[model samples]
Target: MHVLTKVKQPFNFFTESVIDLDAVNFWLQKINPLWSSNKALGKIVQKDIAADDMVSVMIQINRNFKFGQAGQHHPVFVAVNGIRYERTYSLTRLNAQHVLLTVKKVNAGIVSTWFSEQAEVGQLVEFGLPYGEMTVPKTASPLVLLAAGSGITPMLSLIKEMSKTQQLKEQPVKLMYWVKNKSDAAFLARFENIASHYANFSFHVFYTQALPADARVNASHAALVTDLANSIVYACGPSGFTAAAEEHFAAAQNVQTEAFSMSALVNDDIGFVNVTLLQTNKVVSIPKGVPILAALEQQNIKPKHGCRMGICNKCACNKAEGATKNLVNGAQNTERGNLLKLCVSSAQTDLVIDL
Candidate 1:
């Protein structure tokens, strides 16, 4: 039976309060790495190295694991040198027994660096509820997936889901993947195989810094370019790539995007923005196009934060008075009395906010 379908464990007030749960869990691991309580989330089952400094971690999800949409991401908690850190990664369901999470190492990124270089197969990790809007729809409508670099992770999931349904053979789906070079395009073989198997599913790989020199955001197959307006385009990538694709396809009928990092709001009035903290009664001059958290941190005002990519809402606060723009997706929110995430939000004007 599925773990979620099983009856909930009865709470033991005395055991929970009197016993050291941490000590008990530690002992359970001594017997066998996977011998922990059902309440204990999960452990890393295997780790596979990939091209372009990436690692695919297979996890044995515990009874408490809640399934998420195919293209959603979930926060993962891991301890490195005794300190816990949280980061978000897209979940790829391989089977009920295990799942895959592929992480690309960011230069000097703590979590990614740890996983790529040091993390072991049997190390424990915990997952939070998954959430994202980049999921594939039930019906296929000539899908156009534009992915750059690591952004292909979710797109891969969606493509595989379609392949399982044998829709790729009949549906008109085009994938334009941009990478710095061939090495960075980690899943080239898998994509090529899928495209070869399905005549309707065409795959194009562009190397931005390599030969076949015309790689760009506007670069798509001749067939896909003509139908851009009618087909639904889901683009995911770095801030620059996603922003460029969004602008290039601005007139498209339906364009949905998800940026892994923050993009800046492009406007003529780029200048220093004066921000007043309502709670602390402190004022700071922040650059117009930088994350509010980074600007504030430079001025010695540190707000609590986890998963600085705007996934975790730990740094979210009230806008209170002024407008701000998200570095990711390049969207602006001017409404007062709204919650804004500081890690991805940049000041659009001199403003007051509840820090």
Candidate 2:
């Protein structure tokens, strides 16, 4: 057996002077484009149109680019004018040296708007380690992927990956996608092509904002998910869409959901509740059904968080007293010293939490 030795990096005052890891890494990266390390780097090549307000960007990765599973999110960092912003997007691997990132611009989303209108080719960007659990399951049973709006990005990744295997062709794979209109439904042509090639795979696109004269199929969830008893389901979308789909698939034993939006339409009366933060010893009055993270942030208190969707437990805090409600499944809990994810948890009553 032969072993290769690794070279050690020499410390330098030029790029190593900063104490902040991110700051030092940023300076080092900008100073030397050839400074190869374990960090991954990608340069923008082109932005192709996927829909009216959606774009599929091609990025060329460095030699150290880490490979992630299909449906995993890529933490993207870019500088707009003079300020830097970080956002996450579903990334699809095109080849060993290329990847694709899809983004759908929101009404006022800063980073997404930049990707649509301001982002230029040949621009370098930083990507963190991928994170997500809403991937294709490892079972041979039927699979149901539920996606809404830009949530279809990850589903596209799963489609691209599963197409190479015989498992998808042998079993039933279906996609339930919802969009505002036909123009916002990205990748419809590709999905139609895939369905044409594979008999076991199929998809349905639901438009909420418009009904065209000619339609492929009605956007009906009940009609699409007729066999949910023996299938693994994955869903990603806005909070309202995921919440509804969650209720629709509540009986399934294997259901995974991801929602990033902090906004939701309150059907029931949330009213007001008192929240007591033990660390800061501050009391605030807010609605009952909103996430505690948003309530605190409204009062100008910042909390540590990642993904903001309850997948990463970065915002988990202990509750010493009082009841809480999970905004995702609408589950209620009242236990002492219970670890609750603040990003997805809302106060049910007068509460005392160790934030």
TM-score of candidate 2 versus the correct structure, residues matched by position: 0.82
TM-score of each: 0.82, 0.82
Q: Each candidate: RMSD to true structure?
A: 4.7, 4.1
What number of clashing residue pairs does each candidate have, in the order they appear?
Answer: 3, 0
Candidate 2 Cα deviation (angstroms), residue 150: 0.9
**Candidate 1 lowest-lDDT run of ten:** 6-15
**Which residue pairs collide in model 2, if any?**
none
Give the per-residue lDDT digits (tens) of candidate 2, residues 219-297.
Answer: 3464556677887888888877777776777656577878866445554746898888899898888787778888888
Instruction: Quote the positional error of residue 198 for candidate 1 in Å.
Output: 3.0
Q: Tens digit of lDDT per residue, candidate 1, span 1-355?
A: 6566554444344235546767666766687665544333667889886568888888897666877887788888888888988788887888886888899998878888988998887787887778788777756577888998788888888888788878787778888888887778867778888988888888788888986574588644433566776777888887778878888876666887877875444656478989999998988899887889999999999898766777658899888888888887767899999998999888888888888
The regions of model 2 sitting more than 4 angstroms off are 1-38, 212-220, 223-226, 251-253, 267-289
* Cα lDDT over the full model 2: 0.80
- The list of candidate 1 runs beyond 4 A from truth reads 1-40, 219-223, 263-288, 297-306, 311-314, 329-335, 348-350
